[model samples]
Target chain A: MDVETLVLVHQLYGAQSHYIDEGRATEWAHTFTPDGEFHSPSYPAPVVGTAALAKFAEDFAAQPGVTRHVLTNLHVTPADDGLTARAYLQIVRTLPDSPPELLRLTTITDHLVRHAGTWRIRRRTVRRDDTKENR
Target chain B: MDVETLVLVHQLYGAQSHYIDEGRATEWAHTFTPDGEFHSPSYPAPVVGTAALAKFAEDFAAQPGVTRHVLTNLHVTPADDGLTARAYLQIVRTLPDSPPELLRLTTITDHLVRHAGTWRIRRRTVRRDDTKENR
Candidate 1:
C-alpha cells in the first residue's frame, strides 16, 4: 500500500515536472481536477482551472531558456477522505546557460485523488519560503 | 500505517511551526539528526545543525509582530528506505499589521526517520518559489 502510494505520488510529481519542462502547458493543466485551486502566491494571480492553468504555465514556460525543476523531500499519505492523499513538496529549479538561475523553489502542498485508477492533483498551493519579498 | 504516518508527519510540521513561532529554537533544532541538513534556498547560508538552526530561528523570530504560517496541499508517502519517509510541503506565512504580507512561501522537501520510537526530520530543504530575488 505504501509502496504504491509513494510510487504514484513521485511519478505524478515527475510527470508534472516533465510537462512544465517540455512546455506541455495544456497537459500539465490536465493534472488537476475541475474547480481545483492552483495557488502560487508569488504570482500576480492564482490559476484555478485548466484553461487558466494552461495559460499560467504557458506564460511561465515563455521565460528564458531550458529549465529543470529539482524536487526533493516528498512526504505522502492517504487522506482521510477516501481516494485522496495529501503531499508536501520541496522543489527547486535551475536554468543553465545563464547565471544558474533559481526559477522557483517552493513548498508544494498538494491534494491528490485517485481518479480513474490514477492520481491527479485536485488542489495545489505553492507557498513562498523565507528569503522572498516583504509581502 | 497510513494514519499513523500522516498524524506523525503533520504533527512534525505543526510542531516545528509552533517552535519557530514560540522561539523554541533549540527544541525545534532537536527535531533533526546530528548530520541533518536544513536547507532554505533563500537564506544566505543553510542551517544544518541544532546550534545553527537555533540562531537562524532566533534571528527570524527577532522580527517584530506575530507571524502565522499556513501550510496547504500536503502530500505524503513512505520512502524506499525503511524507517524513513519523504514529504513535500507547500507553505505560506502571513504577517499582519502591514497590508496582509506574504512571507516565505516554499516547498519543503523533507526526509524523516523513526528514531527512538518517534519520527524526526533527517533532512529538510525548503526550495525557493518564484517571485523571489536573484539567486
Candidate 2:
C-alpha cells in the first residue's frame, strides 16, 4: 500500500474513539465497506453487511457515553497480496469527565486488501496471547 | 520501532487469538508488562497493572473456548515520544469445532512507549464509529 492509502486507513482506524466520544453512531457506521466485516471473540463471529453494522453502533451508543481506542507498536508489512499489520490496542470507556476504565484486549494482527477504489478489510483476525482485567 | 520489534510485537498481538483459542489463560496474561494495560470502551476503564489484568483473563477464560483477534490497516508513526499506531481489529470466538462468531469492534488507536528494556502497551485506546451485529 502507498503511504497515503495506509495513512487514510490508519486515520479511519483512529477515528473509532472519536465516533463513540461524539456518539456519532451513523458516522461510526460509515468506517467500513458496505460488506466489511467486524470480529471480536467477546461476542460471536464477524458482523458482515452495513445494516448489521449499523445495529452494532446503535447498541454501543446506548451505553458508555464515550469510548476511545488506543493502538501502539504498529508494524506493517507490504505484501504482494495485501498489507500485513500487527498492533497492540487498549480500549477505554469514559462517562463525561470520568477517568476512563480500560476494556481488556491483548493484540491485533491482520491482512488488509485494497478493494475497488478503496481499502477494505478483506480478511482480518485478532489474536491474543494473554489477557487481563480491570478493577 | 525496529522491524524486529515490530515483528515480535505483531507476533504477540497475533497470539491474542491463539491464547484464547488454546485456552492458555496464563499465557494470555503474559502479553503485557507488570504495568501493562488494556483498553476497550465496552468496558469501564483501562485495566492497568498485572494483577488486575490477570483477573481480566480469568473472567474471559470462563467462556469462549477460543478467541481470535484480527488486525488490519496498520500505520505506524515513529515519534520521539514513541511509536504511535492505528489499526482495525476483529475478534472471533469458537466453541470446540463450531463456526466462529464475530464480536463488535471499531478501531484501535494507540501510543506505545518502550519501557526500560522492552515494549509495553504504554497507552492504548480503542475507538469505534460504526459497529456490526452477527446472526
RMSD in angstroms, all models? 10.0, 12.9
TM-score, cand. 1: 0.51
Give candidate 2 regions above 4 Å deviation.
A1-135, B96-98, B129-135
Query: How would you encode candidate 1's per-residue C-alpha lDDT over A1-135 as one tens digit per residue?
Result: 466576556556645764665578988888887656787767777778788888877887787544545455667766765334433343334343222334445677788876667778888877656555413
Chain A only TM-scores, each candidate in turn = 0.79, 0.72
DockQ of all models, two decimals each: 0.03, 0.03
Query: CA lDDT of each candidate?
Result: 0.63, 0.60
| Per-candidate TM-score against the hidden true structure | 0.51, 0.45
Candidate fnat values, all: 0.00, 0.02
TM-score of 2: 0.45
Off by over 4 Å in 1: A1-135, B82-96, B131-135
